[model samples]
Structures are given as structure tokens and as C-alpha cells.
Target: MTATVQPTLDGTTPPAPVDYETWLAAVWPHFIAAAASGRTFTCYSIADTNQLPDPPNPRAHWGRLMHQLRDDGYTRPAGWTCSDRPTTRHSGVRTWKGTAAAQREAAA
Candidate 1:
């Protein structure tokens, strides 16, 4: 059976959910750019800054994306800070900074 997207109260259909790999491919470059800035950042901050599309499963996939980036030598944990996401009520979140590899990628 095919699943249908329901229209919201405003009568607009929501965007189709993107699979993890597709969403990651779309947003990776933006994340890399943010990482290359060499400033600490939260996942939400980068998403908001770049207006990235939400992942299919935000609660899990977002963290997965960060871990993948770290594993790829693009970013590293810098410290913890309160999230700037309006809906997050300023909860403590881990922050990341660009690694040397990210700088090299940016320079290339």
C-alpha cells in the first residue's frame, strides 16, 4: 500500500520525509561549511543557519549525522553549551569544532 501525505490545517501538504542518506547528502556540504568556520556549533545551529531540511528521524538521525562527521575526521567535540533552538528551552547540548581535515577540505 502507498502512504499518502495528509494536508495540514492550512490546506498545504507537508513535504515528503527524506530518508537518512538522502537528507545527509543534501545537508553535508552545509555542515562542512559550518565546520570549516572553526567555531563551536551545535547541530541545530548549523541546520538553522543553512536552512537544512529535517531528517526523517530527527531525534536519532541528527546525532547520527554528528557522529558520522566526527568519524569522517571533519569535526570533533568542543564542549557543551545551551542550545539556541527556540523550541529546546536552552537545554545543554554538545558543541563541535572543525578538525584540521575539515579545514583542508574547505581549502580544497
Candidate 2:
């Protein structure tokens, strides 16, 4: 069964949820570029802070994007954690680094 997406704060219907793979395709280039450049950034930064265009439902979209990145072999460095600020999603927000394979794919 499909899940219903709740409306945004302004009462407009939220964008339909895209499957992880589909969403990943749209955003992986950004991740791969960051990774290739040896940057470490948080999903929270990309989502909540307007790093990318703020999706209609950033919390769900970025949360899943980060999860799928890990599953797809993106690496996270040691001793890093997400912001501890109260409004943040969670402390588990991981810092991701790019992999050679991802870089190649992005460059293609």
C-alpha cells in the first residue's frame, strides 16, 4: 500500500514521494561532486539549510537519501556527528565522504 504524504505547513499538498532510487538519481551527482572534492557534509545541512533546493518534504526526502547513500557504499569518516542543536533531526546525522566509484559515475 502507498503512504499518504501530509500537507506542508502552508496547507498545500506535499510532493509525491519518490522511491529512493529515483530520488538518488536526481541528487547523487551533488553527493558525488562533494565526495570527489573531499568534502564532508551532513544530510541535515543539505536538507534543512537550503544546500539543495528545499524539497517539498525535506525531512522525509533527505532522511531517506542519506540512508540510501550509506547502503550504496558511500563512506562516513570517524569521530563525526551531526549538530547537537535542539531543532536538529537527530544526533545520528552522519558525515559522508565520496568514493572513487561514485566519483566516476558522477563524471560520466
Best by TM-score: 1
**Model 1 Cα lDDT, one tens digit per residue, 22-86:** 99999999889988988889999889988888899988999999999999999999999999999
Residue 65 local lDDT, model 1 = 95
TM of each candidate vs. truth: 0.88, 0.51
In candidate 1, position 68 carries an lDDT of 94
Give, for candidate 2, the lowest lDDT window spanning 10 residues: 47-56
Off by over 4 Å in 2: 1-25, 48-50, 55-57, 82-86, 89-92, 103-108
Score residue 72 of candidate 2 by CA lDDT: 76
Q: TM-score for candidate 1, please give it.
A: 0.88
Judge candidate 1 at residue 107 and give its lDDT.
86
Clashes of 2: 0
TM-score of 2: 0.51
lDDT of each: 0.91, 0.63
Tell me the deviation in Å of residue 42 in model 1. Answer: 1.2
